[model samples]
Target chain A: MSTDLLTEDQREALQELVNIGMGQAGASIAQVLDEFVKLSIPRISSVAAANLSQEIVRLVGDADVSAIRQAFTTEFRGEAIVIYPEQSMAGLHEVMGYDADTKENKGEILLDIGNILVGACVGGIANLLGMLSAFSAPTLIADQTPAYRLLKPEHIQARVALLVEVYFVLEERDFRCHLIILMPETDILALGQALDRFVDGI
Target chain B: MPLSILVADDSSIARKMLIKALPAHWDITVAQAADGNQALAACRQGNVDVMFLDLTMPDLDGYGVLQAHRDEDLNGLVIVVSADIQEQAQVRVRELGAIAFIQKPVDAGKIERVLKEYGIQL
Candidate 1:
């Protein structure tokens, strides 16, 4: 269970750290859109590799969504997945200041947004926790696919996933996307220890 | 009299970090609220002289609390401490009546500097 992986205090500390990281991510997106972005309180849990698809369906409710994945390594190793509902692209297009002619380039735009958000957020958390990390360029994992069908068979090879979910919304324009950070169980112990050190220092 | 300080954030760790970042030499009484509703309740009871608030929370975020503060004419100086460091968020908080804004992963130096700059006497 997620609770067993980290003590109550460690989990709380990790959640707070994730909050700071997501805030940086929100700020970066806000800058790009030149608007205020609403941020959600981040939620963390551990899911078995086999349950990954079920978990995605649970969070996103089987909607047709566009998803991107960026892998990060070093002390923190895992993938940062950004999922956006298909309908949000129009809003994103308008808010991003892209004209009709450039609408076809929306995929590129999504990848860019994914890159900025994942980089700023994951990077912010790493810095706060004193972990060094490097990120690969983001790739499109799924385009307007059912949430449950988003992940490939090979992606579920990990024994367990440390799932962190945070959402960013541009309320007025009705655009929103979610970021899920998944670290394999192999790194969970290290993360738990880091959280402990962080709490102790505080 | 010791200043009554309230740290309002959904995250317990964030509250702790903010409390730790407070000036060690200052004489103050601290209160904590895990959400903005609790923050407003504390203000209504005249318990908070200065508030360190987070913008994102489970219910009634910092902006909601600030709006209510203005609506109720509540007494307390509000300082927003949040990870949402966008210029718009900052401007919105200022317009909503916050005295200052501090970004998260807050440090002692930043807290002290903001306090000093705002003429908040310890």
Candidate 2:
């Protein structure tokens, strides 16, 4: 049984991989918004499943928010989630070319954006890792409670993930989201092979 | 043959994407490999000038392939084109004799810059 989810090197390499995925995700969202959307420098950390919610809460902050979680399967299976701060919804709508007070279903639009970001990110990761993976439709996790809990079912097998904090910014408005990618079942050899490439000088 | 270039990646989509990013004035024999092992094999066949490689692959991932290249002192220049964009990966690939690192969602500008850095015209 493996004790650690990732070595420093593996985390670094995975971070780099996630960076590209996040970049693609951010780019997709920017395209839809038709504005200069800035993406923050992404970070990857390994926290146990037990502590994942705490980490999520810390990153998510205490704000009214909405979330979209999507489960994906490839050679390894896991989920990709994006949580949005509620205050930014109006700004997003405006940036997306909608009138500020338009009666359009904001939740539906949120899900659509999540779907595009998650799909592009997952596709980029799969394309990089050389594995075929498919992501399920995004599911809303409500606006009142912390959305990370939606991912922590009793049967969840992913022990760790490369946590990417993705923020979309346009001028004065900032929309924050978290892209959590869970690592699936893998033999020790597979894990080691995946990480060994970046161990140099580490 | 003007110059042979090996495009190595696990994803057919990515490989095609890299190929499509090549400039119009470029004239080279573009070889394709689906995994690191095949990438190494391409090097063994010789006369390859540049390799656009991805780090994570099924059999013999990029690091292993790069190590093999180092051990055998392969002549082809390795240009890592991957989604792994960490500085550590970039440094490691450079140490392994890769000449450049281009992150994925690769564009023509990046490709052109790396090609110019290596003195490969067009």
Candidate 3:
């Protein structure tokens, strides 16, 4: 029995797959905004689920966080998360033409934006992986500190999370999001097969 | 006779792109709205043969537009044009009575194809 979670090659391949998925997403967003959308894959890391939130804050920031998340199941099931700072959501709303006075609708607007982004990102992943996955309606989470605090107790025993950090820039605006793929150790093989199918499809 | 189309989206750039992407010789009248509420009001005044709606908008989203007009006995075809291209999103909009789905950035080829599919000739 092998104790290794994911061979380095597998990690690289998975990261490459995620990059491709995000590329499609970026293109779609650029088209919608009628602007050039640039995306970069800054880093990929494997960490314990217990430290996921802390590591996220370190990579991005500890400020108010808004995210769009969805789950996909093929050989295994895992969540795809995209996190952006709270201020970025306001910028996004502005781009979408919401009135300045409409700030009160931030929660729903943020959820919808996240829904579109995460839907595209996760859909790209599912298409690449050759998996038939459905997405649940998106929900918004505000204030990462409290959310992480709530999640801390349940995440303590979990180990090994696959984190992919992406930086997106729309003209003058700079924003970052993390696409974290979480799966149990037992599902690694299934994930590999899904990746294999995904690569072949591309 | 000039055909009229309603273009609804929150992004000014997107609206401009769609206008630029339309065929130069297509004898059509274009009506633009920034959101669903404005779109609904425009539809009430008639002369709308097609609608290009973005799914994510403040005030009212694309789905709301569809719902508001579903029973209005309007003569226009509702086509959902959005950056949200996930299969699920497409399915939802189609279920809401959209006649067609065109992904964002509005490619000329895609627009041509969809127009042809719906029997709208330039």
Candidate 4:
């Protein structure tokens, strides 16, 4: 069977839905950080497997990066992404009330932050989809790489990905991040149906 | 009788959500703390029956707070609220003497379940 990729309209609607979700996410993050969080509407696009990394780098710009990722499974399943620019982790730590002196606690701190941010983002999406999503706890990945790097080789080879870039700004700091929602092409139809139900209810 | 509770979380959203999830009928006075230090202070200054402590904080984590007050004769329950779901983390917090472990993005159902399990009438 041929893949049912998102049409332009479907893509636009999904992007808007994701933006609303990210608005809630930004508010949640701001509250944790105790600073105002400014977020862009999130630029949405689709990319083939081979060009995924280059496209992400171009969109986010050249900077040392860290990412918090979580996979969400509804009736439809996909990955959600939240990336941070270099040094923003420190800002996050400050928001959580940690200082440089506590470097030993980085793993715990990073994981906790990732869980909160990614959980909120994915939870918001699940709400929009009108589905209950079961999530695996969030994981933090450092080093600038695309989402595919973390995926199984079989997944990278077979699935076309939907990438949504949600740019976040907190206080005076700027951050470029992306939420990549990827599904097997076979699941696109089911995803579209779910999105339709969600939009109608909203 | 109002049960005084202290809520410690770094995220204002989590705190707000937990407050909202409290049973409206319960006679309760809520005090908020942004981190463990404030939580410790609240425990010292006022009567707190239960504390909802977030595990991850800057100055002192939930574990640190529990350790600090472990020997205190304050009669209250300490429920650790965290996003870390790792079994080891849960086991460690339990070993540290948390009365209960609650994962974050707390909802009404979970709270009700916990209250029921603890035999606390909400």
| DockQ-based CAPRI category assigned to the predicted complex of candidate 2 | incorrect
* Interface Cα RMSD in Å, per prediction: 0.9, 11.9, 12.8, 12.0
Every candidate's DockQ is: 0.82, 0.09, 0.02, 0.02
Candidate 3 CAPRI category: incorrect
Per-residue lDDT of B9 in model 2: 81
Candidates in order, TM-scores: namely 0.93, 0.58, 0.54, 0.54
Residue pairs with colliding backbones in model 1 are: none
Candidate 4 i-RMS: 12.0
Q: Give a tens-digit lDDT track for model 2, residues B1-122.
A: 57788999876656766787887678888999989888998899887888888876767888898899999999888888866554555678899988888878678898888778878775
Which ten contiguous residues of candidate 3 chain A have the minimum total lDDT?
Answer: A144-153
Query: Best DockQ goes to which candidate?
Result: 1
Name the runs in model 2 displaced over 4 angstroms: A1-3, A98-104, A146-162, A184-192, A195-202, B1-122
- In Å, residue A124's CA in model 1 sits off its true spot by 0.8
> Candidate 1 chain A — worst ten consecutive residues by lDDT sum?
A95-104
Total backbone collisions for each predicted model: 0, 0, 1, 2
After superposition, candidate 4 runs with Cα above 4 Å error: A1-4, A101-104, A143-157, A174-176, A200-202, B1-122
Question: What lDDT tens digits, residue by residue, belong to model 2 across residues A128-202?
Answer: 767777888787766545445544645356564445565556545666566666565363235446446423312
B1-122 per-residue lDDT for model 3 (tens digits): 88898899765545766777888888999989988999999989887888888776767988899988886866688888875555556777888899888875467788878888878887
Q: What is the C-alpha RMSD of each candidate to the true structure, in Å?
A: 1.9, 11.9, 15.2, 13.6
Ten contiguous residues minimizing lDDT sum, candidate 2 chain A: A193-202
lDDT string for model 1 (B17-119, tens) is 9999998899999999999899999999987888999998876988899999999999988999988888888999999999889998887888778777878
DockQ of 4: 0.02
